[model samples]
Target: MRENTEVVVVGGGYAGVMAADRLTQRDDVTVTLINPRPAFVHRVRLHQMVAGTHTAVVGYQEVLAEGVRLVTDTVTRIDAGGRAVELASGGAVRYDYLVYAVGSGSADPQVPGAAEFAYPIAGLEEAQRLLPVLAAASASAPVTVVGAGPTGIETAAELAEQGRRVTLVCGGVLGPYLHRRGRRSVAGRLAALRVTVLEGAEAKVTAVTRDAVRLADGRELPSAVTIWTAGFGVPDLARRSGLSTDALGRLLTDETLTSVDDDRVVAAGDSAAPSGLPLRMSCQMAMPLGARAADTVLSRLAGERPEPLNQSFGAQCLSLGRGSGVFQFGNRSDVAVWFHVAGRLGAKMKETVCKGIVKHLADEAQKPGGYSLHRMKGGAGRREALEAVRAEAPAIERIS
Candidate 1:
């Protein structure tokens, strides 16, 4: 290894920040975090920000490690051969190792007039833009939230709590990840809040206008404000840089989180596809992935073997406005079970989850590799995922 090993982490979200902070554990290593924004965005609270209930931002000082340097700029391209990254700020950063954590954003609406008329709540800028529009509009104007994912559900509930006429156009079953009972709890809350929940394929949105949204069933609803939280897509920097990526443009990595193309490159968060089975795009997965990514690099540097990913979800937290929620429990494999916590207790759990996310990051920032969580042991599911990946391509062996 060189006298001073330089590690560059691209992106300042949950994954990047955690990875960068943890990399600071080593005395001989230097960590530089490159991001477009100066502040850390608490993405889970973005819905509340749109509803004018939260700020959705935290200072890097509160979360970033003391030794880690922050660069407020975007990475335009990755020069894998040269082991350097080209930045939008008109310079290149050379690194011995790179952590690709540039996260996901709002996917293209792809519907007629939807792109032009519909407001999205995926990122900070989009939320900021929608805030002014919502403020200027009439209090009783009809508001439509497209997509029934966690983001859409929270946004619809928040607006309805604020006394807006909210309509949720679910493209399919509401909360596809939730159990039937949990789904019922959410539906009950929405009903209590007077927010209309339209489910099934017929409720899928077809297009949007300045004044309304058209459904797949040829029905149109008056929507003075249409908020699209349909789905997320990762930044294409990985694909554009000639790295091996999944169908969705996520960088392909082994179970250890090291890039298949180069051992010196790693991936985490929404932009990583490990063993052909990418984790769900949630904060619940990002922090663990980030820690694993750091471990891979540290192990390689120390000439030690790195452990494969042993990941599993425990529960899904859904906030209904600021007063109600559902803590839908899941098994080791992340499939929802019959049990759940509803109402204020659930809301408190959801709040704890949100606060815990930031606290976990800050803890890792201070103590580096001090974070730990109980993960499921490898089983048939992991074997099947690896078998599928090997069936298509050669297995990527760990370098060290």
Candidate 2:
């Protein structure tokens, strides 16, 4: 009989959970998931958590597969040569395969006093930290949300709906990824919610202080609470472990999500930079990446070459408030198109998606290998885009 294969997934986010659950297809494989938290964080609902709408946490028993062993610990470093990972608890877990799915968190704002004063809502703990701060502030206090990405927009709308005075600092264009029409819809919703929408270069935050945010135009806006959601940054685990990583610290991998340094190591979700080109860091993309990463390991175990990434995005959903949202449709390549669903319907769509994400994970746990969205027939645009970049420069020089 063949020896059992041990797989270790180093994250419990959408990607890591999906990968670990799907690996149960083979009885000869033992799966272990390591995460800092014991519960699965519903990151999509973190804004709602801050607004006292949802708890944003689910027990691992509800999502993780029965066959998988749960390890509640943080991975400090990966000893690739030893095929083991060092844990913060002063222990190690050896594995025949490792899936790097440590997802993203809010980037360092780098603005003065921003780190000291502003709250970040990218993770569970960050959102929880903001809850008490919000409760302590006066009801009439002005709240400033920095960055106009989905997170910033959702947070501002959520707070505004709760009767909190809110201002959204776009930094540049509001919803840079949204179509002009979609952007207009979002603007209308924010206007209805009484959120002060600040955009353009002049609206960029120059600095953040305890009681105010200074804009590039030298205007200081009173802000009792400041929330930063500008961008995301991955953990430095890859770089610290001597693994090849992109400029953003994402694990550098080949088309098959296999690490260039070791065949036994694969990557998924926001932390994966496959072919130096990565999909947008979102829950929509993470689940597919996780499934594909598991497929890569399964293919190798079967002595077959794994297929390259072929997933495609359909839409970007943003919850404006409890009753308002905008579902911006996108082509297979993920670029926002002209079509969108707005208002109540959009809110319903967003809610369905949020619940569907958890359901997908739970369903996959019940039936391993049943989730096949990652293998859909698409990604031609992704391939063409990669080829165009290759034509202009060498692959090594085209990291974006």
Candidate 3:
């Protein structure tokens, strides 16, 4: 292995940050992380921020590991032959190893009038812009949610709690991801909050004016505010460069997270769809996937074949309201495990999950070589005790 290896990771989300941080631990590799924004948007907290529950605009420099170079720019092109990343600012970045962690976003944008009128709860910028719009609008204003997925349900419940007349228009089965009882439980919660759940409503939102949603059903709902949270499509860079991509533009990867076209390039987070086991785009997947990507890269550098990714996680955590939530335990394949939780306990658990994410990033910085879990300083710079181990201990295996 050369000491001057240059690794450029594209994407500032969880996967990119974790890969860059882990790589920087080794003195030999020069890591450059490129993204469009300087701040790592904590998407899980967007809904809370929109509801005025929390406010901590996390900056990249704060979470990024020391000695790692960060470049803020959108990647426009990828020249694999030359190993050069063409940036939007008419510049180029070369890489010995490339980690494609650019995640997914709102899948379809061509929905008629949806972009112009509907608000999305994806990231900080959108949520910040949406807060004032909701606060100033009438408390009794009719709010129509376009999906009944996890995000749509959470948003609808939150809005309903805020005393807005919420009507959730689900095109198909409502809460199909949840168990039958779990689904009905959530429906009951929505009803308690005065949220009208409309299932099997084929709502082709033809036009979304400032006042209402013009549906193809000829039933014009007086939706003073429309929230569209459905259909997330991965970034198009994989297919744009002619790399083998799925129908949704997700780069087809092997079980080891290696791109099908090029073994040297690894894809993670939402942009990756390993052929055998496809993982969804959520905090649950992104967190572990980032660590797995790090493990694969580091193992390859250490002359060891990384284990195939068999990480199975489908526990969908959804925040219902300020102090209410539903914890649906699902098997690896997204089948519910027959246990659930609601109310304050569920909310506390969700809060702990958010805090743990931040803690993991902080823990990564204090560990040497980012190879294994060693004794590291906790939050507030508190020293942690370490256990003595052999020099040839396995610290970087099965990153979990």
- Measured against the true structure, the TM-scores of the candidates, in listed sequence, are 0.97, 0.98, 0.87
Reference-based lDDT, each prediction: 0.91, 0.94, 0.74
Clashing pairs in 2: none
* lDDT, candidate 3, 350-399, per-residue tens: 77877877767666655634433211111211111011211334222122
Runs in model 1 deviating more than 4 A are: 374-380, 388-394, 397-399
The superposed Cα distance between candidate 1 and the true structure at residue 336, in angstroms, equals 0.7
Best by lDDT: 2
lDDT of 2 by residue, 151-212 (tens): 99999999999999999999999998999999999999999999999999999999999999
Model 3: pairs clashing at backbone N, Cα or C within 3 Å? 107-233
Error of 3 at 395 (Å): 31
Quick one: best TM-score, which candidate?
2
List the candidate 2 regions with Cα displacement exceeding 4 Å: 392-400
CA RMSD (A), model 1: 1.5
Tens digit per residue, CA lDDT, model 1, 223-317: 99999999998899999999999998999988888898998899999999986688889898898889889988999888899888888678899
Sorted on TM-score, best first, the list reads: 2, 1, 3
Q: After superposition, how far is residue 224 of candidate 3 from its true place, in Å?
A: 1.2
lDDT of 3 at 47: 64
Global Cα RMSD, each model: 1.5, 2.2, 8.6
